[model samples]
Target: MGIKNRLTVMSFLQFFVWGAWLITVGNYWFGTKGWSGAEFGAVFSTLGIASIIMPALTGIIADRWINAEKLYGILHILSGLAIFYIPQVDNPTLFYWVIFLAMMFYMPTISLSNSVAYNILKNNNFDVVKVFPPIRVWGTIGFIAAMWMTNLSGNKASVNMFYISGFASLVLGIYSFTLPKCPAQKSVVKNASWTEKLGLDAFKLFGTYKMALFFIFSMFLGGALQLTNMYGDTYLSDFANTPKYADSFVSKYSTIIMSISQISETLFILAIPFFLKRFGIKQVMLISMLAWVLRFGLFAYGNPGDGLWMIIMSCVVYGMAFDFFNISGSLFIETTTDFRIRSSAQGLFMMMSNGFGAFFGGIFSGIVIDKFFTHDGVRDWHNIWLSFAGYALIIAIAFAVLFKHKHYAEDVATVTH
Candidate 1:
């Protein structure tokens, strides 16, 4: 197979491993295992905990001690084993640790996969900027496909979803070894500080007023990012408990219904360049925060019946809520930071948004839902979603009032070109 096809397969299975279980796992936790929301929140926080330390540590290891592809493959294989074991654990606390181990192995590969792909693409004389996005979109397609498979196969709330994910992860692990080599570049400066060597230099951005505020908000908004992912499917599926909506399509196929969010993600990604050009970064991001409000507010009123359009609209708005802030935030870092620390700044962005954000979102949201939203073993999803909407609104207002930036047409034009 050609390199593009090989990378395409790589990309597809990479996300397929995640897609198989990420969304519907809430169903497995709440619906299948009958776990408490607080505990399950801790479960999702595993991603945050793992993201906090693993990616940077692994990056250092891959740069010094191992070939990127080899390390990537090993991590996947170990993660697959951990995922396979998830079905056997009956205790929630034990399951948290298992999933945390799995995430530790799985999360770093997201960045490593990009590194491997970029390396091979550049080696083959392809323009990574032009060629890679098309290949990467297949990852989303793969994710959507996995969600459909999990739902249609009636494994949305079953251990079988983990089996599907585990086996795919194993297959991807072995396949990674056969890809082109990405050898470590071990040429460190003779006098590099421990911090610089570890990529901790990006933390220096916290000293700057703008970058510090940007990161703080990144963490806050990051908390908002995973709320829907954590609950949307479970919320829809819970409609089954109601007599009128019990047999509805949304309840039966919540995963597929929720796949609309991913579809919306693809569309919104295409719209970012246009939006950024017209509104600039701050305005575009503010639009994103407002979109998150709409995303959750719509969900608060949506149902599987006549209000299904609200659910769908909420998913549609997700594209803007997610892409605008994330993509624009990355662009902001790229355009503004010094070249010496740019790569580290990018890593710090991921650390803030995905790492700390996922952690805070998972732990606190779970606690809040358990404490305030749950009653007599049932959840008030309407109120739950409304609370989330309120949280997003506060973040939007704070961002508008406190975060400052001027639109530079030339800078945005440079980025687009």
Candidate 2:
């Protein structure tokens, strides 16, 4: 295979491992096990905890000692074994530890994949900026494909989904061993202070008021990103309880409907360069926040009967809502931070958004739904969505006022390369 094709395959399997279980685990927790909301929240919090620590440790290993590709393979193989074992654990506590181990091995591979791909591409004289996005889009497609397979096979909540993901991970793990070599880059490196080595210098950027405000808002907006992932599939599957809409297409094919968001993501990612050039980072992110408000509000009013379009539209807007913040935020960090601490800055970004943000969203949403939205042994999903919509609106308005940026001509020229 061509180098690009090889990278594309690697990217696809990376996310395929995640999509198989992420969207539908709630069904298994709440519907199958009849677990409490607090327990489920604790289950999901593993993702945040894993994201905070694993990536840095793996990066350090890849930089100093091991070949990146070999480490990547080892991690995936261990992760596959961990995932395979998930079906055997019945208790929440044991389940947490198993998945935590799986995440420890799996989470680091995300960045390692990027590093490996970038190193290989640059070696082959390819442009990382222009070529990487198209390859990464396939990862989203892989995620969508996995979701569809789980839903269609009626295995969304079944332990078999883990088996399937494990099998795929095993295949990917073995395949990774055959990829181009990515040797350690310790020859030109020098010893440094602990803070410098750990990328702690990025923390100094926070002393500047503007960067501090931007990261603060970035953390809040990250909270919004997880809201849908935690509940989107469960919400659609809940429609099966309604007699009138029980047989509707969405309830039957909830994963396929949810896949539209990922499909839309592919297109929006390509459009990002244009939007960033035309509107600047501040405006692009503002547009993303407003799109998020619409994403949730439409869900509040949407139904299987007359409002199905609203549900679909919400999925469509998800592209803008997600890519606008995530991709742009990464670009913002890239442009603003010093090169030496850039990796750590990116880690901090993921820490705020995916780590703390997702942790709070899972726990907070669970409490709110349990306290206010559940009654008579049924969840009032409509009102629950409306409340979420209101929260998004408030965040959008606050973001608009507090985040100040000017679209100077130089802003367009800065990232043109």
Candidate 3:
């Protein structure tokens, strides 16, 4: 196979491992295991805890010591082993630790995969900017395929989903070893400061008003990011409790229905360049925040019956809510930061959005749901979604008021193209 095809397969399996279990894990937790929301929230927070330091640490190892591909392969294998062990544990606290270890192995590979791909592409004389996106899109397709596999095989809420993910992860881990080598770069400056050497210079951006506000909001919005991922499938599957909707398509195929969100993500990615050029970063991001409000509000009122449209629309809106802020925020950081600190700044962006953001979102939302949304062990999804919508709305209004960006059409046009 060609290098691009190899990378495409790698990308596909990378997300497939995640997609198999991510959306449906809630079903296994709430539906199969009958876990408490607060404990489950801690479960999701493992991603946040791992993201806080693992990616950067692994990046350093890949940069200085090991080949990126080798590191990536090893991580996946370890993560797969951890995931395979998940079904054996019945304790929620032990489950959290196991998943945390799995995340620690898995999360860093996300960035490492890109590093390996970019290194191979550049070495092979390909135009990375032009070629990478097309290959990366396959990852989304892989995710959708996994979701379908989980739902259709009657394993959406079963331990089998973990087996599917674990086996795929192991396969990908082994396949990664055959990919082109991405050796570490040993070009570090001898006179570099400790902060620079450690990739901690990005933290200094917190000293500036604009960047401080941006990172703060990134964390706040990041909290909103996984709310749906943590609960959407569970919410849809819960509809089975209703006699009329028990056999309905939406309830029966909740994972597939939720896959529409990933599909929408691919479409919205295509729209970003146009949206950025026309609306500027701030406006585009504001549009994303508003889209989040609608995303949740629609879910609040949606069901598998006549209200199915609202559910589907919510999935459609997710494209904008997710892509706009994430992609646009990266662009904003890229265009604005100093050349020397550019890479670190981007890492900082991910740290805020995925690290602190995921942590806050996972932990608090779980507690809040358990405390306020649960009644007699049943969840009030309507009020739950409404509360989430209200949270996003507040973030939008605050962003509109506090984020001071003067959007010049010429500036955006120049930067985008």
Candidate 4:
């Protein structure tokens, strides 16, 4: 295979490992294990906690001491082992830590994969800006493929899901060893301060009012993403409890249905350039916030019966809801930040959304659902989704009122892919 194809395979398996377990784990926790929502919340929080703690540290290691590809491989190997151990963890608290361990090893690899790809592509004379997006899209396809494998094999709510994830991760880890090398920058690391090495220098952005609000909202919006990931598949799978819908395709294949969101995501990424040119970043982001409202509201009303289109439509809108803000936010950072700290600023953006945002979203959503949305061990999924919709609406209104930015088509033209 050519280098691009090899990189494509790497990208594919990178997310394939995650998709095997991520959406379906909620089903396993809530259905097979019969765990409490609050505990499951803690379980999901592992992603957030890992996101917060691991990426920057791993970046430092990849920069100073270890080759990026080797570090990426090691992390995946460790993550695979951690995941393989999860089925043996019968205790919820132990499961939380085990998953946390897996996430700590796994989360950093997402960024590391990008770094590895960028390094190899640049070295091979590929235009990363033009070539990378298509390569990265394969990761989404891999995620969809893994979801289908789990659902079709009837392992969506079983320990076998972890086995699938673990096996793929190990394979990817091994494959990573054969990829082109991305050596550490031994000399540059020697000159940078500890704070710069840790990406803490981006904290200076918070002193500016606009960037501060942007980071704050990014964190909150990130939490909203976790809310859906935590429950979307579980909600569909639980339709089996209702005799009227138990035989529905959705109930039988919730992971496959939820995979539609990832599908939409890939399509929406293609549409962002047009949207950014026409609507500018703030409007595009506002559109994303509104799209989130629609995503949850549709889920609140749609059932497997005649409202199947609503469920499908919600999945379609997911592409817009997720991609719009993330891409636009990245553009905002790219266009605004000083060149010296731009990379660290981007890291800060991920930290706020995927790290702190996901952490709070997982913790609070679980507790709130247990207290207000459960009755006799049955969940009020309708009210649950409506509450999430309300949360998105509030965030949308607040963003409109508080955050300010002026749009210049020329500015975005240079910055956008």
Select the stronger candidate by TM-score from 3 and 4: 4
Global lDDT scores for all candidate models: 0.84, 0.80, 0.85, 0.85
lDDT of 2 at 287: 91
For model 1, residues 1-417, the per-residue Cα lDDT tens digits are 999999999989998999999999999998788888899899889888887888766765665668888998999999999999999999998999999999999987876776677668767887554566567767877888899999999899899999999999999999999999987665667799997676566677899998999988988898888888899999998999999998999988899999998888777766766777678888998999999999999999999878999999999999889878876786677567653454446556766777899999999999999899889988999999999999999999999999998887667544222
Q: Rank the candidates by lDDT, best first.
A: 4, 3, 1, 2
Per residue, candidate 3 scores C-alpha lDDT tens digits across 187-306 of 567898887676555678899998899989998998999999999998998898999999999888889899999999888877776787788888898999999999999999999888
Worst 10 residues of 1 by lDDT: 338-347
Report the CA-based lDDT of candidate 4 relative to the real structure.
0.85
Model 2 ranges with Cα > 4 A deviation:
60-68, 181-191, 406-417
Better of 2 and 4 by lDDT: 4
lDDT of 2 by residue, 1-417 (tens): 999999999999998998999888888877877777766766776666776676655655666567888999999999999999999998888988998889778877776777677668777887555676788788888899899999989998899889989998998999999999987654433676676555456667778887887878877787788778888888998899999989999888888899999999899878877787688888889899899989998998898889999999999999999988887777677567654444456656766677676667767887888888888658887887888888878888988898788775455443323
For every model shown, what is its TM-score relative to the native structure? 0.90, 0.90, 0.90, 0.91
How far is each candidate from the true structure, as Cα RMSD in Å?
Answer: 2.7, 2.7, 2.7, 2.6
Better of 1 and 4 by TM-score: 4
